[model samples]
Target: MNPAREAMINGWKSPRKGDRGRERERDITAPRHDSSSRISKPARQQPPAKSTASNAVGKYLTQDQQSEQFVADEDKFVLKQAKKKADIRVREQRAKPIDYLAFSLRFIDTDRDVFDDHEGDVEVDIPAPETVLESLNHAQLQELHEDLTSYQTLESNARNKEFWSALLVLCADRRQKLKPQGPEGRALASVASDVDNILSPKSLEQLEALEKQIRTKLQSNEPIDTDYWEELLKSLLMYKAKAKLRKVCEAIKAAKVELLRLVDPEKAEELEESDGLPANSHNFAPSPAKPATRPVASSSDAQSSAAPPPGTARFSSTGNEDFSQATKALYDREVARGVGEGEEIFAAEEAVPSATKPLWADKYRPRKPRYFNRVQMGYEWNKYNQTHYDHDNPPPKVVQGYRFNIFYPDLIDKTKAPTFKIIREHGRRRGESFAPAGKEDTCLIRFVAGPPYEDIAFRIVDREWDYSAKKERGFKSSFDKGILQLHFQFKKIYYRK
Candidate 1:
């Protein structure tokens, strides 16, 4: 036989046909190595299952005991899998406890570890009183005027009464530290509730009567006869004080749909009409148009009287407690010259000499300031001024003085005619300054010099930072703490050697 045939007869497998031939040849050439007397090892058996349930998704069937009739169809398989999963989930869910009363109870007895304890002294984040005062100044009023002009066109674009109502309600609310208790404590809640009740089907007649009565009383400036409701009606009327009663009218009309649903339809209609006064009523009429005709005045027929001429400026030394008359006269002159209402006149007025220094500048002057000598950049220094210790003759204690020593690119001229310029504090260990030259934006630094650096400490008075603009003053010092006992100022120098 061939070597390959002989290898096959020996009951040994070959890797390939060529390898088989080589293996057969080697087997034939070499001694016979094996006899077929070895027994095969048996396969290992799996552990017995605890239950008959198979934890897999399919028709349950045994390896040899499968009956085609017992096999589950696709739908049955899916249904069985879903039930098994659902049962497992239910068992897991039941393992955990559910606190049924937790959600229903208003208060809990659990440990109060979530909230922080109240400290004896707590700081509030309200705006400073000084900032509030600034907001009420002329600067804020000017800003409001600009805003009014910019947003006036969109005023009538939407009929969103809710926005106005919500704002009014918020303004009426005053509590700052805690949430409102309920409808009684919350003004918004009360208003919303009242609105809801008024829109109900049964209250329509009462709403109509209320509106009619309110309208009549408003026209006559008489109070409504209703007990407490009269005050509520009055408040509503006052809310429309700046409007043509149109806002009130519109609110009442909107309430009609709800009122009719709650009350009688006839009553709802009456309230609607009352909310909006009739066309003939004075409460609803649009303002009359101004006349277009211009008045003519004769040139020579109007001979000049003893009255002051136009553009004539007047200065008075008599300190009147009330300058109303003088102010009105000035305003009239401007108006006659075509200056619109309350508009500022930039034109220079006729020059009139003052008899005395202005009271506004000296009315609240400090006694006397202490003086100091220091040239600094961004450091804070504090010392006492001589004014605080002087019981007898008081010399004007001024701020620290520095001589103009070096001429930098941004030096400001202090003599004769001076121009505003940038300043940098050179000697301070900490701090930086960059000033630009401009009429409106330049800073006016006051410099003073009197004593040695050890004599007094310089302080800042009425200095403020504009956090919104991320800008701060360059020089910030204190006079021996908060007391302004010393005067300190900055000065330029021609040379620093």
Candidate 2:
């Protein structure tokens, strides 16, 4: 270290600058020949072999298997996400509506306890008549009808009666408008409304007496508007049907209450004591000794206590052969067939009076069968409409077709099917239009079925039906499985340039 520092001092004092510069250049240009001075580089690692096994397996999978695999994978992912969210919610102490309901129900002693406090009180707030009538659109009115019918079956009380009557009055007013009648018809309608209100509270026997009187009037050769009398008879029958249904529902409710009472320990003990069983009977009772016979007695008691099947009891309560399985089936079918989305009800009538009674009227009472019909509406892109409207701004929808579904489950003659006839007013023939400008001609399409089911009719636009067998045209007229379905579309008129 001392010699190197002396040499570096001598070099710094030397005046030969050219020789020192040439030596530094030579040192930088020279290569390192020593083994230790050479640095080693790491070997290039080959990339891991690309996996073709997954691709090969995927290539062999069928369409259905692939779909199933995709669904399973999606389900797994959804389950994972749901579980994670549930854990987070649990940690946050968030409760769902059902959880709250379950917690509240834990304190309740019995089912009856939930409603005992609010007995004889209306649970829901009913809107005013005007408000309801104005607010309810076509679909809402249909829903209201369904709800009221259900309420009538479950709870046929004074409150429900008031609601039903109000609906009836509304319906009557609508009917009068649809079927414009003379002065005599108007007078009869007012009388009918008053009679309906009076008959609302009448017992089954009283209603039966009134029905007989009306029928007698119809059967007699008296000067009377037959249509009004027949309508009255039909209404009477409907009231009778409702009364019978109510009685059955009340009986069922009572049975359920009795069963609940028996289930209660205290009530059971009270009942046993009331039935002349001694308090200390258990100590001396021979019932335990003959356990084999107890099952037989219990079985018999169960059979006796069981309520009759509804289908069998349906028409039996009326004590008449008039209301058959067909009637009940039709009623149920109509109830189940609610208004379709985007479809409008053009005209719906429960019963249309028949001019003449069938020959088998005595054997089976002639009554108008129930029907639920619909009118399909859609934009008709004719020359006028196409010129004025586009997809973004559509034209007004007109009645494109009619769908008539009538039920007659228990037709007397199964071999013979129902038929329909078009009845024109003012002696107007087919293709003849006596209607005012901008109005279309209309006619009654009366559907005639076998005995016990009277003729029902509906007014429809007088136009040629599209009888094409194509699905788009939707022309169908057939009676199958107790339903008479007549679906047809109007023939579209095209204007050529």
Candidate 3:
């Protein structure tokens, strides 16, 4: 055996029983040719070596000796020139701005038959330098991952001669060079304990054959098979997808924890956990163990937990509660616990901003006002006390001069449960005047119609206290500016003319 082969043999015994048989088969099939046969014969000549003392004497060789040395040097020079030319060609090929067709074929076609199809108007736009470098780095990482995975699988199935032989040869030829870098390299270091168990002469032989074939193809300018490359690309994509899913689940768990923290700071403090999403599974260390579930609260406990202290603002069970107030209170509770601004909380690094340019007013960019007021009303003029004699305190019916200019018609219909509040406060008047406590009915409209569609449907509740009990009020109407007005009050409505 050669020195390299002997060293490999000394490292470990064969991992497969069929190693000898495969070796014999490979040797029998290997190509053999006469070594003495030459395609082109050149005239044999000997050249004199220049003596060290000849430098002091200036020149020592005669014309005949010089010609012989030139002939010998010419052969060496041609060989060196050919090698230099090959090197230059490789560099030029690599420097040629990315060949889109070739790149597409690298992923799409294994035999690379599509390389010839690159002559069309298919020009690959040169990406920004950073983008190109990033992609190249990713490709290198992917290549390392694939090689390591293959090596690992082969090592595991060492009992199978086909795998053992292939792996052994790969390990022998590639050894230090095949070792991965980055995250994959770290993983490889961890799992490379059974290298001795997987190496054998047969495996080495198989790897050698494959390596030779690849080198031959590259030298001959032949393309690799499409099916092989397609399967490889698919495997890479699947790995990436699985890693992405894992990351997404980890992020969701982290977001849930943050939300829980915002809801109850004391509970968040009790938990005392880290507050960030997991690192990407593709390149990071394995994930930590799942967090434990929080203790569940009993119904009574939850009720006690939600109840406010005595003397604070309280909603009576009998009184009609405002839905908007309830919604706002719930939202505020969430925000206080840990909820961040929506866009900042969810935005990811990889997302690219949209390129579509907007109008000058909106450029760079300007935002429209989100709040506005339509009408003003006096607080005291809007309030009236409910009489004990009346069964229900009816709302005032408005006499609108227009029908089409309604507000929130779709959301404020008869089906809606509207709540009205009467604010009571005492205000100081000018000198010599005493301010009396006054109340105003400000109806809270929960459902509002969006812009461009103008219509407001309102509920005229007869019994504010008995809101759950429905009463059908008769129609009342009034005519003004060619529009008829309808009013309903305390189970009675009038049609005005």
Point to the candidate with the largest lDDT. Answer: 2
lDDT of 1 by residue, 1-497 (tens): 76656557876543376676456446465655456656658988988755535643245545644554344344344332332322221221110000111110101212212221112101101121112222232433343234333222222223322223322332222212134367444645456457445433333345456668666766784555453455555444333321322343354345434435454666555645563422231111111121110001111112222222232222111111111333223322322333222222222212122223333334332111111122223212222323244435443433232212111111122222211222223332223333344211222233222111011111222122322321221333332221222122343223323
Candidate structures ordered by lDDT, highest first: 2, 3, 1
Candidate 1: deviation at residue 113, Å?
42
Query: What does candidate 3 score on TM?
Result: 0.17
Of candidates 3 and 1, the better by TM-score: 3
Tell me, by TM-score, which candidate is best. 2
The whole-model lDDT of each prediction reads 0.29, 0.54, 0.29
lDDT tens digits, residue span 452-483, model 2: 67787887888999999988676999998778
Worst 10 residues of 3 by lDDT: 290-299
| Model 3 segments more than 4 A misplaced | 1-225, 264-439, 443-497
Q: For residue 185, what is the lDDT in candidate 3? A: 53
TM-score of each: 0.15, 0.37, 0.17
What's the CA error at residue 47 for candidate 2, in Å? 22
